[model samples]
Target: MAARSKVMQLFKALHRTRKEVFKGDDDALEAARQNINAEFRNNLTESSPEKITELLKFGTDVEIILRKTVIQGVHTDHNRISIKPRKEILLDNVPFNHNPTIKDT
Candidate 1:
């Protein structure tokens, strides 16, 4: 009974995190919903207490990672957010020179 309760709690927490993290993105929210449902469904047959505990730990870790990294929100200077760009894009209206030779007199 306790194990079942724990599982339910974890499931609910995951959904909440998804809602908060994927705000303004319906496709992402739906994808997360599907993935979470599929994972829980696939693990329906899991019975061993040890295995359940391990799985729960993994789920918790995943939630923490997603909240800390994937999710973006307003942050302070002390806690800066880092977003990595896939590829460098030049700013609009910026002039680019191919060759530059410095002649010193």
Candidate 2:
């Protein structure tokens, strides 16, 4: 009972992440939606508790990866592309080493 709810929750979270990560791109959204559904459907009959637990954890990891690493780009014109970046992929807020200097010993 509880495990079923957890699976559903993970499924919903993945969908939400897909929408945000693939906004303005119809193809990506459709592909990701289909893959998510198919993976879950393929394992619908698994009854082993250990395998189920591993699968759930893997799903959760995938969701996190999508949220933190995904970025979108749009081809606005013949010669230009526009990048749509979420904060998760932005490095402006992080401390970065912009330059390194070599010193003689």
Per-residue accuracy of model 2 over 1-105 as CA lDDT, tens digit each: 888898899989999999988887899999999999999999999888899899999999999999988778788999998888898887766666789788899
Residue runs of model 1 more than 4 Å from their true location after superposition:
72-105
Worst 10 residues of 2 by lDDT: 89-98
lDDT of 1 by residue, 1-105 (tens): 999999999999999988877776688899999999899999999999999999999999988776766744433477785443212222357667788788999
| TM-scores for candidates 1 onward, in order | 0.67, 0.81
What are the clashing pairs of model 2?
none
On the 0 to 100 scale, the lDDT of residue 75 in model 2 is: 86
lDDT of 1 at 70: 75
